[model samples]
Target: MDDTGRTPVVDLRLDRAHSARIYDYLLGGRTHFAADREAAGRILAAFPAAGAAARINRDFMARATRRLAHDGMVQFLDIGTGIPTSPNLHEVAQRIRPGARVVYTDNDPIVLTHAAALLRGRPEGRTAYVEADVTRPESVLGAPRLLATLDLTRPVALSLNALLHFIGDDGADRGHAVVEHLKGALAPGSTLTITHATADFTPAAMAEVGAVYARAGTPFRLRTEAEFRRLFDGWEFIGPGVTLSHRWCPDRPGDALRATSAEAACYAAVARKP
Candidate 1:
């Protein structure tokens, strides 16, 4: 609506703190406003390692994408695709397979506003964005742009990194149900990659962090390692099964041991649909 030629379907809401923008602020990006920076300051006071956690989580996404592309998977569907950070999922995959196709879906209007950055993929490859929420898996999978960009009949690498924590369990297993629905829709041999925040490693710090997000009107639920593993039920885990974010198929020597479990505060894994 503000000159992008496409009317904004939702409000930008710069007055409120958004998880995506808070993350951008924590990562030292200039895309955040004062509200986001204020919330980020509270989060850092509660969990000083937040910036490191964000970086390591992003690094995991890159490693997982490269591995999947190297394994010959040519399509990627990244739900909760956040603000388009450099070396995005498509950038990583297309680096390995120039013709790789990627569909990035997110509920954030800011992400939708800057989607052009995400769309800039290699000429041989394709990238598309869907302004949809992850809770509504049908809308994401059935989106016209998503369908046109990637062939669902083929193996696709699906990533839900650092996203599930925002979806409260609500005592009905809603989070797990959402994942199962998405998993069922994918073809056999497709891979599911996830990096989720957990309280298992540092319960007190994570609890404080959760309180901060809650006060900001965002639901935050840090899961246990068992709960995280259950999200991948019925799938075959790849090598180095279910480790800290920095430990999952680390790309460098000593990388796995670099961050303490409490500092990482997140669990990550890659599994095959088989």
Candidate 2:
């Protein structure tokens, strides 16, 4: 254990080829194995901009959280919460709204292993970490431990960031099902913040990236803009709906349109409950 009452979280046998660790490597994180690094390197070699795309996705998370905290009073439910990246959802939200409450969920055992970092929150705010799968929403919301920290009576901002690709697009593995369930459970004024990788901009690179994930046991599936918009069917999308991650309400004007091709591969939008 590394003083967090949890194990050091380095497992090689089960699967050194996990999406979380691969992403960790891409983002210059130190929690990846040689195999994961190799995969990430191959992807980066294919698209030299993959690292920048990862950074843009990370920026999207921060930007979306800023929107939630300043413009809305809703709590947050962040699923597919990856490794403990700095300025995480809770950190961003709580910084803006000191009383903001956040609940994080991730099925990855590695994420669970490092969850201790997620529990840290502003003294005035609330944060809780739950080890659960997005494919099973009931198990998450119904978990007594998490429900205690988050109040379901009001709105909650549900974030699905760079995670949908991991969910198979078939009948049972469909990620839309997970979104439907969570959106169904939220109250009015709630918001859904989603950012997904797409092949609309870079077909060849996207194909190769998908293949890399496939070989690593985490095949990526790109969703079209229309299919992604369906995720917010009932919600009232804020201005600039279903736009590129770099286009979604940047800190200032004129930034979105000039976004690079790599960053544009990811579609990001935030919609509020009507």
Candidate 3:
């Protein structure tokens, strides 16, 4: 916590809790601190299957990216891009198309610190990082790197995976202001991919779980189908609409259904801009 009142991307607050680090730990990454691991363990003690859930979400990301790159012919704007997890959106997209472009944005300084790995994309393609808040869609859109990645006038896939819940409204519109603003910027054929937490199932455990994050200042916002869908008012949901993370084009059998309660409470969806 220096002049920025925060750790340099890598200056992790091991003593405090953080969603990104907790997510890293759950994903079996070694960049987290002991405290992060402990916090994640406590979360697992409650849900008992958080790690697997996180993996499922990551897998959904891969499936969605593959679908986009194979034919979308657009760049990617991956906001809330977590730490340098393998098979990152860019990696998956670039794999399918040698020169796919990706622009990742996150508020975590740790992400900025470890971004060297995130930046190592195919030479023919482009990869860049922007340290900014997802709520500030303007700054994110204005980043020079993002401008360099692709033509904004063309269709783009905006990956807001596990991001919108963290952004809410006080007395604003039904959907967060930023989301509307973001969607306004996308081209007609662009896509919006999302994975959000829900309390549609497992209310008790999910409530307690939400409390844990709130107390740690890493609060959670569990949305309903209608409320979540409102974020994409003009966009058309792809086949299957909004479902659980595991159900979003899952790769393996027995992995294509979303959990509907605290015993299961994650939602995933991909939609196209009309």
Candidate 4:
């Protein structure tokens, strides 16, 4: 702990392969280490469209954020925020609503190192970063920075893109329970947007990809369409409910048609609390 008595940030552990770093590597970011690159290589060999899948997932995030911001939602809570890439959540939200406030949470130390990029926002808006794990919803929900930046009583958009798959079911409803806990905390009209990896389209390829992640010490559980839909159980879906990542409000006219569900390998949805 520093003189402030708060816990110090953990080590980067560049030798270890973290799911976030591997995702960074797949997204063509330079923040990953050799370990992350190696794991991404294996995943690519198993599923050649892994990079495209990552891009599709990212596009889903931008679209969802824009839709929420345009719809007058001014606060955002993004958990499992990976390494900072251009057009971060704040950028997309603030573009539509300059007063939009965003709180990004992630356990990865590398994301903390690059937190500054996530914090640059318009003078009228606010952006904060909280280094916390999604598995411990209380840690994120109760964070001082989060509490200061976002008003829980107000409508906030929560995005969990490409994250829950890492939290494996374990036959105990692990990921689902986390979502439920977070959902219960938000006020009515708050939105929950998620993009999760699934094996429903190509079970063999996704299984091989999961094996690669497991070998890298990351637990990856690819859910089915039914299981993915269960994450947003009681929430009201916004548009094109629980479709393929690229198919969820594609920007271009034929963009969704160009990418097959097997190529995307992920499902995307945005729902609001009743």
Error of 4 at 197 (Å): 0.4
54-129 per-residue lDDT for model 4 (tens digits): 9888888999999999999999999999999888999999999999999999887888888889989999999999
Give the per-residue lDDT of model 2 (tens digit) for 14-118.
455788888888788888887888888888877777777787889889998997788966489999999988989998998889888888888877887787788
Please state the error at residue 59 of candidate 4 in Å: 0.8
- Give the range where candidate 3 is weakest over 10 consecutive residues by summed lDDT: 1-10
Write model 3 residue lDDT over 26-47, tens digit each, in one string: 8999888877777787888778
Where in model 1 is the C-alpha error above 4 Å? 1-6
Query: Whose TM-score is higher: candidate 2's or candidate 4's?
Result: 4
Q: Residue pairs in steric clash, candidate 1?
A: none
Candidate 4 regions exceeding 4 Å error are 1-9
Candidate 4, poorest ten consecutive residues by summed lDDT? 1-10
- TM-scores of the models, in the given order? 0.96, 0.92, 0.91, 0.96
Q: What lDDT is reached at residue 58 by model 1?
A: 92
Across 165-244, the per-residue lDDT of candidate 1 in tens digits comes to 89876788777889999999999999999999998877888888888788778889778889899999999998688989
Pairs of colliding residues, candidate 2: none
Q: The CA-based lDDT of model 4 is what? A: 0.89
Which candidate, 2 or 3, would have the higher lDDT against the true structure? 2
Rank the candidate models, highest TM-score first.
1, 4, 2, 3
